[model samples]
Target: MKRLLILAALLPFTALAAPLNVDNNPNQPGYEIPSQQRMQSRMLNQQQQNKGMLNQQLKVQTQQQQQHLQNQMNNNQQRIQQTQPGMLNTPSTKPVAPRNGDMLKQY
Candidate 1:
């Protein structure tokens, strides 16, 4: 029948016109969803910014550590040199005096 044909034709469009579901979650209030492109761009930008900040921090920390290590090494060298440079390196320093116990002849 022509009426049946018309009803069938309109049914598909009726389903399309139905309201979209929202606020399905009960625990939380409604939340906004940004467009896919905008969210992706924001995520990428934040990631890069965080990575850059971390990289700078790491670079500064590493440089400070390297300088600290270099200073420590320089201090150690200075201490070594100050303590006994000629005795260890140059032969001109007098030999260490023999201990009295070692002078006794072994049986």
Candidate 2:
């Protein structure tokens, strides 16, 4: 019983005397030593900034692609409109002349 009491007192003293080494060197690469809350906040900020830039780039690229496709479609439509009359107005009822007498006989 006495040894148990002594050990219990020593245990509390050991707990109180424990050292807390919490210093982190900022100059070290890939050394993540921040508190949980600070680390989360920093990660969220970085993610937001990256997402913002990515969204901006995606928007610009989408707009450029849409404009390019629209221009191509307009050009194709204009060309089709310009060529439609020529195709539709050509005479299609004429019989083709045979190149040889044998072909004419077969027809």
Candidate 3:
């Protein structure tokens, strides 16, 4: 009867010990499962970094295009002013004289 009692007490311990051995097997080859929340957070961080870089590139491109257009507009305005300075300042109302001696009278 004493042996039976001792065996009964040790049976529960053996059952618990078996699971511990299986849990602690470091050399067992298997897929490492990352927790779902950790994977989601990592993916979100990567996406945000990509978006930030893209936004910075776009901003720089837009600034460069605007500067180019402004320079072109300034150069065109300068050329126009040099070509016709009086045209911009005064409106002429005189009728131009004909080169030939024939005059057409407008009554």
Candidate 4:
């Protein structure tokens, strides 16, 4: 029982002492670091490309929105012009004179 316990304790240390192969030996079942690195780089590159495409799409959408707003403003201005063709004339400020004031002369 003591030997079994000692073996179990040394087993973890023995596994740590063994060096994993840098060479992707097909016989060994460990992961290949170089392949993983290449895949990560490819993923990063694809992400950058996707971001660029999104930026382009956003710019196009913004331009379309601005154009739509500008068109609406132009239509509103045209409607206002159609409603009022000319400047409004001002009212006359001159006072009217009273007609036939013979009562005042008699008084």
Say which candidate scores most in TM-score.
Answer: 2
lDDT of each: 0.81, 0.81, 0.85, 0.82
Cα lDDT tens digits, model 3, 1-107, are 99999999999999999888774565667633457658988999999999999999999999999999999999999989876857665576899777665876679
Backbone atom clashes (below 3 Å) for every candidate: 0, 0, 0, 0
**Model 4, backbone clash pairs (residues 3+ apart or across chains), number:** 0
lDDT of 2 by residue, 70-104 (tens): 99999999888977987665567888776766464
Clashes by residue pair, model 3:
none
| Tens-digit per-residue lDDT, 16-71, candidate 4 | 65655435565667655777889999999999999999999999999999999999
Q: What residue pairs are clashing in model 4?
A: none
Best by lDDT: 3
User: What is the descending TM-score order?
Assistant: 2, 4, 1, 3
Candidate 3 at 19: error in angstroms? 20
Candidate 4 TM-score, C-alpha based: 0.51
Which is superior by TM-score, 3 or 4?
4
Candidate 2 backbone collisions, by pair: none
lDDT of 3 at 1: 100
Give the Å error, residue 53, model 4.
Answer: 0.2
TM-scores, one per candidate: 0.48, 0.52, 0.48, 0.51
Give the C-alpha lDDT of model 4. 0.82
List the lowest-lDDT window of 10 residues for candidate 2. 17-26
